[model samples]
Target: MANGQEWWRGSVTYQIYPRSFMDADGDGIGDLKGIAQRLDHVASLGVDAIWLSPVFPSPMADMGYDVSDYTDIDPTFGTLEDFDALVDKAHALGLKVIIDQVLSHASDQHPYFTESRQSRDNPKADWFVWADPKPDGTPPNNWLAIFGGSSWEWDARRRQYYFHNFLREQPDWNFHNPEVQDYLLDCVRFWLDRGVDGFRLDTVNFYVHDQLLRDNAANPLPWAQEAVRPFEMQYTLFSKNRPENIAFLERLRALLDEYEGRTMVGEVGDSHHSIDLMGEYTSGSNRLHMAYSFELLGPDFSPKHFRSRIEAFFKGAPDGWPCWAFSNHDVPRHVGRWLEHAGDQEALAKQAAALLLSFEGSICIYQGEELGQVDTVLSFEELTDPEGINFWPEKTGRDGCRTPMIWEANAPNGGFSIANKTWLPVKPPQQARAVSAQGENSVLAFYRAMLALRRAEPDLRLGNTGFVDFPEPVLGFQRGDSLMCIYNLSPEPVTVDLPSRITPVLEQAAEVGDGSLSLGPNGFVIGRLA
Candidate 1:
């Protein structure tokens, strides 16, 4: 890597979900112009980059996760010129731009899928994963989609079943086909030529499937209970996480290497093998620059859970790097998700940023986490997320998290748009936490300070993490030899030894003295190692 080539390593990336980020046209949907207009806010946070979540042309069957065109922006978002302008503006603001690349699948309406599904003998027939139905015409295998049913959906056009790990409208691409791989690479090159800094590969592990099409085995471990999604009942060994994907990643990496200072961070969605695969995908010099998993984004909030995930990643892939985030468009915001374990939402929000920023890898900050944005409470009729709609009472979907971002507290639709209706409603609770309503002591201010602190302190950014022995609900760690960080993960106060030779940082979230560190509810201390 050249000097500054590893800009993504240990950097802070602000993720932008285009549809909810901001609306420039009063059309009730966020667009590229909206994002470009908001660059100053993102740059003000000291984030090194902005990762846009799929702005490509799409039928939006999966809310932009299913791309219809590989090389152009969706009409709802903007055009190629608008995208180029957004990239230029981002670079001018000293922030890199990372676009989402959903290579695992494409919208069923994509020309490639449209052409391939027409007939088995067409030039593009093998472009997507198409298989003959079993002898009984009951579909190919027992692989289930994350959305709830069998992964195989019958295509009447070809008289066969096409595999999809997500919605049936999003068809999986056949990475086993060399031409398909070449096409995807060409799409990547198009972006690189247009000057994107990197890519956030969506569902990175689902790129390739087992060639044999064998049935997935039953999940080994008892999840302690019933799974909300039937897909969780099986291990999906054949449907995804295939070893063949590594070769494709290498090819992608090689293509990225063609451009200077470029990088790629993949989202590993595996449950059982996430860590192991995170290691394998980024372990070497010829793969992804960084990979992140759902380990930290869930409801688990404890010293044990934190220590285990971080330590496990390093132990499994010592040479690999990880990007960590507490919230994203996919999950419920951390403020609400971890409130059961760590009360005092504001304190927890600041504490979460402190803990995540102090860790030893690149960090991602979701759009409204800085504002202490909690998940929006929506009624069944107001829900828009398919997952939330599919699993209704049991699982209100990602719409709670994907609601249009709140900007001005009093502005209509929380300043997200002037239209009478936005894609998702901006509830009062969420609007109350808007940027305009925040103060100096607010979670938003704390985030700005914490992020600036990380940027200024090399140890916080480039340091290797060493877990400090601490009791439950209190997470402690040494960041390289320069800093010591300890946090109280619960609402109850706790006093513990300062681990010796540690002095409180100027921006300490709480008090410390007399060789004993006192942590209030959701309190934390980042100290310099003397």
Candidate 2:
């Protein structure tokens, strides 16, 4: 990377979901103290930073995402003093802390929203998105919420409809109001003053909405195999991904720039225009340091899919930077998501770790990814996520992936908590792959090796990539003329001719014999060109 560029360029960040990471207070829920106590394990992975999910005060309406207080920590999680200690411990371990900033919306229980709904003439009345109903008392627009039903919630006190893109309890903030922007900026400053190194902007494309309150158009065609919610039918142009969001991001970037060596990564959730939006949000220096899409987090795991997604982003905006992750808190774990393509879970996990580390951008490794954690099967009674409950049986919600982290094989609650029950149950299968069970050649060790390899080789981190012409299951890419990274994403062993100038790196998952390179099922190799 360029000398003056921020540390986020080609950095690997470990994502910690607080509710599932560890429980220090024995309340069966993870908290700030738990996270602070676990910094050693994160530092051991050779990652440059840690990106924490939301830990702000909330009503638990949407876990911590539907934040009621932005400037302080929730009592359940701990206090502001505990957060400061985590930051200090992390920095001492040479790891940066990048917390989630849910700027697009706030909980309906928030003081701003409470005052806004009291009366139309209140001081904070315009702080949120509120619209008048039609002549027949219908919603002004046909936009739908991500959770389910209409996006607008009828406020009895104001006798008007308020916009909420997710849960009705989470009201979308009005970026059109300068005071709202100032108020949010002040909240951001609160963290910056507390010594946070960076932020991961949650639903960054959703800060602004169409001022005209226009209806969303129907999707040209259903992209997913099944549509579980009404929101999927529409393209969602008026509800989110507005052009005015660019100016707001610029303002946010300006605030981040005030701190030395700080960075920002925005999450773009738009399926159709995510890559283009990622390019736009990160291309200019005045915007996000990096932005990630759901492209890698989806069910598509073919060589063509990976190549096309990577190539398309560079094609759209060559200067734009991207952050890639195979699994996160939102989606089903990649192991289960792409299980059909796996010869074996362990083999696939190792191959995936190598492939992700070889990619030419920043990387985010979810908490359980190193342990090869799969989605745990949960019954309807065990389901806690509303997204899953809304479409249960047919579509399992994210509860499977959000189970507590397994740190020990035999310990109760898998060492996540001392309490009798966890927020999510820790199944026996998850405990089997706990960190304590890993050895020198285990999946956890393989993750450490892959991360070390990425750090040892600069080209794998920040090199220009060009795909080699190859068929399905075999992905070949040249990184900066020196690194030739190849992967066989199939169960059957395959052989490919080695270019005369390239010498194999002889990594554990790869092999070279005579003039041919043979890759085992779910194997990969990174060779250095002579």
Candidate 3:
């Protein structure tokens, strides 16, 4: 990394789903104090910063994504004082605080939305995306909601259809309205002034839409097996990834630029155009610092798939920076998703961590990923994720991944909370891999070692990636002059010919190599180039 480089690039960010991180009030929900108390644990992992999910006041419809107030801390989570203390403590511990900014929409209960819907002539009337119904009283266009059903909902008071790409209660803000853009920018300023180091922009591409409200074209491959959301059926050209979004991103970047070293990373959700948009959003110094997409979070774990995704971004966006992760609140844990090829759960966890750390971009590690936590087994009755409830058998929702972090192996509820009933069940398998149990000679330990190695090795942390030629099921890449990484994503042992002059610097196992390397199922090796 260059001197005076932005802190976000090549940094390891630990994400805390506030609701599931830790509960301080015994309300079965995590809060700022709980996070403050746990800062040392995150800091001990050698991560550069923490990305906290939304803690703003919400109706919990989309679980804090539907913000009712942009400034106030939710009472359920904590008070403003608690948040201030969290910032103080995290900074004391040398951890930067990056928060989730859901700028695209607000809760229906928000004052802006309430007043916008009260009458068509109110001062806030144009704050939201409101459209008139057609002659048949149907929605103005064929846009679909990501949660399910119609993207536009009928409001009795306004007698107009409001656009909501998510839940009906979470209405999309009209970014085309200059005043609306200014107001949202003020919200960004408010947090930045309060010392938030950066923002993880949620649904960055969804910030703008086609002003003409054109219907989305049908997806070219309707017969393909898609994920949990029904919104994937459409091409989403008009509904999201609008050209107008770039200027707004520039505006956001300019605001953050006022604060020295502050940065922003956007979440791009479009399937076909995500990488291209990521490139466009982060190409220049005046735009977002980095961006992430759901491409790697999908079910494909093959070497070819991983290679293509990384190579495509490098080819398409030479100037853009990318952030990579295997699991998050939205997707199933990678361990469970790739369990068939991994053979052993423990080995797979280390393999996944190694693979993510070896990538040539910044990395995000979900809360339980350090402990090698897999998805919790959820019963139908205990599930709380709306997406999971809708897609039961084929694709159980994200609740499995959103389960509370296990801090204690034997303690009740894994010491997540004092409450008798958790919103999501913490299974025994997960509890066994709790942070306490894995503090030594465990997967968490492996993660710490790998992260420390990355920080110490300049080539691994800030080097360009060049793919080395390798056979099927074997992925090989060299980072700059020294670090060479190889991953075998197969169920059977395979022999690989190594570069004649290369020697082992770090290997995941004792028997990693002896001139010609023999790799076990899902095995990996890291060596220094001679």
Each candidate's root-mean-square deviation in Å?
1.4, 1.4, 1.6
Regions more than 4 Å wrong, model 1: 1-3, 506-509
Full-model lDDT for every candidate: 0.90, 0.90, 0.87
Where does candidate 1 have its weakest 10-residue lDDT segment?
A: 501-510
Which whole-number lDDT from 0 to 100 does residue 415 have in model 1? 92
The residue pairs found clashing in candidate 3 are 388-397
Q: Can you write out model 2's per-residue Cα lDDT over 1-530, one digit (the tens) per residue?
A: 22244789999999999999989999999999999888899999999999989999999889989999999999989999999999999999989999999999999989989999999999999999999999999999999999889999999999999999999999999999999999999999999999998999999999999999999998767564257777888898888999999999999999999889899999998857999999999987999999977889988888999999899998987888999999999999998887788789988888889888888789999999999999888999998999999888777788999999999899999999999888899999899999999988889998988888888788888889989877778998998768998898888888888764567773545777776678888888888886
Compare candidates 1 and 3 on lDDT and give the better one.
Answer: 1
Cα lDDT of model 1 overall?
A: 0.90
Tell me which residue pairs clash in candidate 2. Answer: none
Error of 2 at 98 (Å): 0.2
Which regions of candidate 2 are displaced past 4 Å? 1-5, 222-225, 506-509
What's each prediction's TM-score? 0.98, 0.98, 0.97
